[model samples]
Target chain A: MAREKRRWVAYGLTVPSYLWLAVTVFLPLIVMLYFSFLSKMPFGTAEPVLTLKHYKSFLDRDFYHFLTWRSVKLGFHVTFFCLIIGFPAAYILARKVHGRWREAILLLIVLPFWSNTLIRIFAWTMVLRTNGLVDQMVHAIIPGAPSVGILYSYPAIVIGLVHSFIPYMILTCYISLQAIEDSMIEAGRVLGASSLSIFWRIILPLSLPGVVVGVVLIFVPVVGAFMEPRILGGRQSIMLGTVIEDQFTEVFNWPLGAALSFILLAIVMAIFAACYPLLRNRMKLT
Target chain B: MTRWIAYGRRIVGMMAGLAMLGATSVAVADEVRVLNWKGWGTDEAWAVAEFEKQTGTKVVHDYITSFPETFTKLRTNPGYYDIVVLNAAFVEKAAREGLIQAVDPAMVANSADLYPDMRDTPQLNFDGKVWGIAWVWGGTSVTYDTEVFKTPPTSLDVLWDPAHADRVCWRDNAEDSVRFAALALGQNPDQPEDLDAIREKLRALKPQVKAFWKSGDEWLKLVAAKECDLSIVWTNNTEAAAVQDNLPVSFIVAKQGAVAFRDGLAMPTNPPNAKGAYAFMNYLISKEFYAGWVKIGGAPVSANSKAVEELPDSSLTRQVLTQPDAIKRLNFKGPLSDEERQTYLDLWQETKAYFAE
Candidate 1:
């Protein structure tokens, strides 16, 4: 009787949170799915009919295919760059730095989160535009170098995205690295392991979970980002996210937009599913 | 455990009480909520304040950047807004969707003060019923750096000139870009006889464009920075670049004519405060408010003739408004049919793809 009462109490404790999630997340997702199969927005005066034409439109247009590929490629490039730059900085902070200075550095690394992201991206234009700060500085240094203004270029988009998301990578890696005891390194050294070997065999495999977490966190959102690319990439940018945005905002085609969104969600889920087994085995080994 | 449950119940009770209080206060207040674009000139705040004092009804403003946003907001949150200022192109669609209601001229006392052309404009009136009141209008003209061209270019051909390759910016909008291209080719932009030829022309002009700007501010920034020598921009933006930012730029109506756009004030269907909305709409057309709108907002002309006559001769309004030829050159084409709009969008997508490659 006591055990039965305890289970009831536990169920009561979780019911509110479960109900909140159902209302906010699951309900909208189900509605989007329903809308995706409709011929028109059911709310407006237009007659609504059940159809698969919205999904078929994606397959019919090569533009949508190209944009999806581009978005995926962009995600890979951003994730690769973030890992390349972030892992080293995180290592230094976790293993080399100590006490108050380490905390200060970590805080400084996280400072970008305090300000609005759109404002920061806009500020980059001032640095990268013609006759702006960077150009003037370059001219001052070389006395007449060709203008290096690269705002509205693909590189500028990547730079802005990296600046915005590198903190996530650094923070995730730092937590995992900090958990590694110094005694483990000493033990490896006593066993005649080289620094490279130690890293390859011990540290890296152990930190795979954190790296995977950071990759998922950064890659998923970057694939769906429209504003960063629009502001920085100009005419050069066209991603699945922006195309979806155009459908809803410019075309007023809600059914098609919802269909496209579900496709993107499916792609992201497939990627995660593909990576899951490898990540699980690695975690078990560690 | 019992104590924790008691605390939770108290919190829920307090939240319910707070929600009830909010509901009652909203019911008691006399407020007119307006959904409009941001930056309606310096005089708007002052005019709104004066209107509130005179009518004893609080005016609330919600700003959106695009027509689609206005439509989406109204569709999702019905009865939340009293009035909306949208483009004339959207007025028909909004009315057809039952998102907005017909305007009663009797309610708006200043309806007779509108200029003859604006008062009976087919864009605002559809199916023999007036759905919106014309508010502000402007034209898209060629804005070029004075330093680059000593004499202003007379024709739209300059945008496609080989000598100006990589020195021009075009607005990244489907309708405007397609229409401008059609006009440049001497075709009727309203109903282009040959869409394929227009598409080819746009594709050919891709090499000359430095960037496809999405916003007025972006266009101004590119011009001010000398990143592009010329661009097709709104007249008000050009005015702002020269007068406000002191950028070395000048605007001219090309020989191909300019695309004119007018935004209208319409009442949303089943507004929370319809009386207040009508009063505000009437005040917007009054001589005092129109005068302030022209001066503070840098509007080229007011729909009210009396407001235009009141402006000084040296003002931009006097120069643009007095020129009947400039007004004649304005192309005020109505909205495209759904099928036509889709075709234009497809062509625009293809153009963007070509440039991307």
Candidate 2:
């Protein structure tokens, strides 16, 4: 009787959280799924019939294909840039720097988060535009060097996304790097392995789990990021995410928007599934 | 266990007290809920304050970043709005959906002096009812750097000029792009005969574009930083840049013409506070309100003909809006059916994608 009562209490404790999740997350997704299959919005006097046309829009059109590729390319570019910029800084702090210095450097790395993302993205426009701070500085140094008018282009979008998301990579990799024992590196060095080989064989593989997590965290949102691309990418701003946004906000085509969202969710899930085995071997996910 | 139960009871009591506090505040004030773009004329802090003081009714506002978002909000939540501020092109659609109700123009005391061109438009009147009070109107056209162009550029083709390549900016809106491209091609901007030609023209012009600006402030920033020598921008933004901010930009209606627009106030259907809604609408269209908003130049030009008289001739609002030639050349874009808008949106997006390639 006591065991059954304890079990009941445990379930009672979990039921509220499950209920909250159902209300907050699963319910809206189910509603979105239903909306995705509708012919028209069933608000007011208009009658809508069930249909596959919304999904068919994805299948029939080449526009969605091009936009999807654009978004994926953006994700890759941002992830790659974040890795290159973040890994070196994270490593030097994690392995070389000690005591309060590491803490101060880490604090500076994440300091940009105190300001809003939109403000940071807007700040880049001042730096990247023609005759902007970048151009003025370049001209002063080089004496009539051509202006560095890089804003409102793909490169500008990449720079903005990297600035916004690189913190994730640094922090995640820092945590993983800190967990490594100093003895492991010392052992490798005693075996007469060069510094490059010790890092390549010992340090990189062990710390990769954090890098993977950071890549997943950064890649998912970067692909669906509308504001950075819209604010910085200019005429090249139309991506899969922006198109989906326009469908809901500008076109009032909820069915199409929901359908597009489902497609994005599916794509992200497939990527995770492909990466799951590798993650399982490295991290505790198994 | 007994002490834990007492703690739980105290927490519950505190929550209940907080809820009551919220409820009593709502009960004490009569509120007229308005839905509009944030900080636009209707929701300006000073205007809201004045209205609240005079009428003893508190004003609350909800904002929308886009027009379709406005329609979605109205549809999903009925009886939640007293007033909806919409572009005139959307008024007819809003009425047909019964999201908003029509009022006789005679009801508004200041309606007598409203400009016939902006006020008595088919877009704001349909099914034999005046659905919205035309509040402010402006032009969306070419704005160029005076420092770069010694003489005013006359044609829309100036956007595609190689000289301004990497120095041209355009609005990042599909409808605006479609309408502007149509006008440039000498096709009816309201209903273009050929969209493929417009698509090709836009794709070709993409090489010259420095940016596709999303907001008026961004356009000013771009122009101020000398990133854009030529741009398609709203009239009021250009006025502020040149007249107020000492930028070298000049607002001009190209020989082909410019896109004209009106934003107005309307009564949403089944408003909880009908009397308060009417009082607020009257104040919005009042001469004093328009004149005050125009002086700031943060808002669009007044749609009231009488209000324009209140501004000095030196005021850019008076000078830019009072020109007969500019008025004559204005090509006000009309409302589009869902299918038509979708077609234009698709073409616009496809052209943008081609540009990316």
| Leading candidate by lDDT | 2
Q: Model 2's A-chain: what TM-score?
A: 0.90
Report every candidate's CA lDDT: 0.80, 0.82
Q: How far does residue A266 in candidate 1 sit from its true spot (Å)?
A: 2.1
| Model 1: CAPRI class | acceptable
Tens digits of lDDT, candidate 2, A85-124: 9999889989999999999999999899999999999899
Error (Å) of candidate 1 at residue B78 is 4.8
Per-residue alpha-carbon lDDT of candidate 2 for residues B1-357, written as tens digits (9 for 90 to 100): 334334433433444455445533444358988889876777778888999899899888777888877886777567778889888888888888889998767767788888887788888877777888888888888888898999989899899889888788888788889888888899999988998888987887877987777767777777777778888888778877876788887777888889988888888888888788888888887778876776766457777877767666665545654488878888876777878877777787788788787
Residue A77 alpha-carbon offset, candidate 2, angstroms = 1.7
**Total clashes for model 2:** 0
lDDT of 1 by residue, A1-286 (tens): 9999999999999999999999889976876787787776644444567789988988999888888888887888899999999999999999999999999999999999999998999888888777779889999999969988888778878888999999999999999988898998898999999999889878888778789889999999999888888777766766788778777777677788899999998998898899899888877866
* DockQ for every prediction shown: 0.27, 0.36
| Number of the predicted model whose DockQ against the real structure is largest | 2
After superposing candidate 2, which stretches have Cα over 4 Å from the reference? A1-22, A190-192, A276-286, B1-28, B116-122, B125-128
Give the Å shift of residue B79 in candidate 1: 4.6
Spell out the clash pairs found in candidate 1: none
